[model samples]
Target: MKETTGFREKVVIITGASSGIGKAVSLQLASEGACVSLAARNAERLQEIAQECNQLGGSAIAIPTDIADQQQCRNLITKTVEKFGRIDMLVNNAGFTVVDKFEDLQTLELFQRVMNVNFNGAVQCTYFALPHLKNTHGRIVNISSLGGIVPFPGNASYAASKAAMTGFSDSLRLELQDDQVSVTMIYPGAVVTKFQEHRLDKDGQVRGSDGGSLYTEDMMTADECAEIIIEAAKQRKREVVMKPGKISRWIKLISPSLLDKIIIERVKKIIEREAQESK
Candidate 1:
């Protein structure tokens, strides 16, 4: 992919940089000459990605961090500042989900865990990065989901957490308008990634391949999603809804009942298929 010149020499911190969209974004930014700080729970993977970024013609550092922990989140920011001096952008992309009905066993735990990582983690990182971002007139690119706006079944926790993130980003954008710190929210539909393989099941166990085909043929690629995010950051776009057209968003806003009916039918089919597979 061709590198964008806008991010040249910028300092960027990306959480969940070990794999998927976060990893793709880090590589794209690095290729564009940005100094990337890679943060994730997997230290080894982070280091590997950092090495790759360094070879990509830009600087990078590996900061092993579990965003769910407040102290670790603080450390991530401190380490980034220590290395880069200031933050030009912060990508809060660290999150996970559980695939099961709302009434499934251990659903509460799943919900809490999802919230801690998806919502609380982002909040903590943003709180620490704000001061530096304000200094650089920086940007915050949050990787939210389409589920946040139009939720589907079997992933209540994921949808709720993303919805909360969208709300938080919107409010923060308003508050920071005068500060020159831009906030961009990305609502991705479905992307081809290992996210489903790592998601939790009804028993709070890592969902294996038995979960069946979670991604559809129409899903976006991680690199494609990353490119959109990089562009949004460069242009300071307020929001992006990843869809072929604006009809889905318009329908949701204009006739929510109709949208809900569509979602309900699709979800019912998925649930029924899962039930059949289990038997």
Candidate 2:
């Protein structure tokens, strides 16, 4: 089916807009006629994206923001409103992951940082965008992950933050039903983004690494994930799970034990081997 291009004249806000799925969505929405507000910590990269959007004959602005700060999130929304007058859509796509078994590598400070950006960041942005979104009967797209639905031992903090987003979206969906503000949670399986390369290592430090067992460049592209997310948002869908082996979905439904056994044997092996090799 041909996807609908229903974003014309819409004022959309996208976090983590400098790259990855966020950049893909900003470009896609702008191409479809939305006035996109791109937010991130990188000013130079954001300007490049804004220029690309303008070249497509779409309105866009770069808003340098660190979503971990509530005031900055509010400022992003406020500045967006001042520029485009109303917000029609919000894409919460800014997040990173820290990979290690909870016991082997868990650190309070690291956990807090993950929650701050992955969970609190979205909360702050959503809190401010809700009013503007409600006014326009707009959409909120929270980019969660399959980890949110099913737990991965090495990704405890990441999964927990994403799970929080899912729970938040579910409750907000009910609350905003009367307000005409739709909350959609998207759980993407494995998209080709820079997410894994930028993961937090075991020493509670940020580092870049090459492709591993999962998160392959051969996996679905960021643009593909963005397209699905955009379509779901346009239709105001409640929940979306995109592109994984059928087992991933089944694990959420029936027989987590069976799935856990399979995942632990195979996926866990790869992660373990990768961790050993890295060390």
Candidate 3:
């Protein structure tokens, strides 16, 4: 996707802007002339990214936010409009995984947490930004995952949350079609990000893993992921699926039953490894 030089003077609100894909997109958009508002829970990380944007001769502000809270989500949009006078784009990118065997996972609690941040958070942000987005005919880019489209074992909660976002994006897109507001859903395969380690437990403690690796070996970098997301937003594409792996996409389409079998086998292996390490 060509970087349009027209992003100049536009105001963009990005959740999960403290690091990874969100931070990369914030930097890219800001450098391309958009005034960016970076929203995330980690104040220090947010400050670091904001400083980088400012140093790059771009305008930006770090707004520490816990997107799970509806009030905070509302406040984020309000402050962005107050600071920039309008919101031209919103990137709902705050999310993490709770990848564990269904039997080992605290189903209800984990499901709620994932849904609150991945689905409810996006809803709240979009709801609050609707007026501004409507006024500007702006765009909404939601970061979902391949798991949302193709089910995977050991990621039931995360997959469910992303699927909810996908469905919500579709419905919302139709509702806003007459208003000229575009909603784009991004489905990325595996990307090297802090998502797996940042997943929260029922007590809010982040799940830790030795060496911290969960993505498949062929995972793309966060920059690549952000670039695709930017294009989807700019082109106002209905959906963007990146790293369309041959075997993966084929498995999803050609034989979903086979895909489920493969997922179950891998998940069983993962469970076995976890069990051995715990002992």
Query: Any runs in candidate 3 off by more than 4 Å, and if so which?
Result: 1-5, 200-205, 209-211, 215-217, 245-250, 266-279
The C-alpha stretches of model 1 lying farther than 4 A from their native spots are 1-5, 210-212, 271-279
lDDT for position 270 in model 1: 77
Give the candidate number with the greatest TM-score. 1
What is candidate 2's CA lDDT for residue 125? Answer: 96
Q: Write the per-residue lDDT of candidate 3 for residues 1-279, one digit (tens) a residue.
A: 222325678899999999789998999887887899999999999999999988876789888999999999988998898888999999999988776666776447877788899889999999999999999989999999888887676677888999999889999999998888899999988788787678765545687664245565678888889888887788888888765544767887889888878878977887687676667
Give the candidate number with the greatest lDDT. Answer: 1
Write candidate 1's Cα lDDT for 102-203 as tens digits: 987553777898999999999999999999999998899999988788777888899999999988999999999899888999988788887877898778
In angstroms, give how far residue 234 of model 2 lies from its true place.
Answer: 0.8
TM-score of each: 0.93, 0.92, 0.89
Model 2 has an lDDT value of 0.86
| Candidates by TM-score, descending order | 1, 2, 3
Candidate 1's TM-score reads 0.93
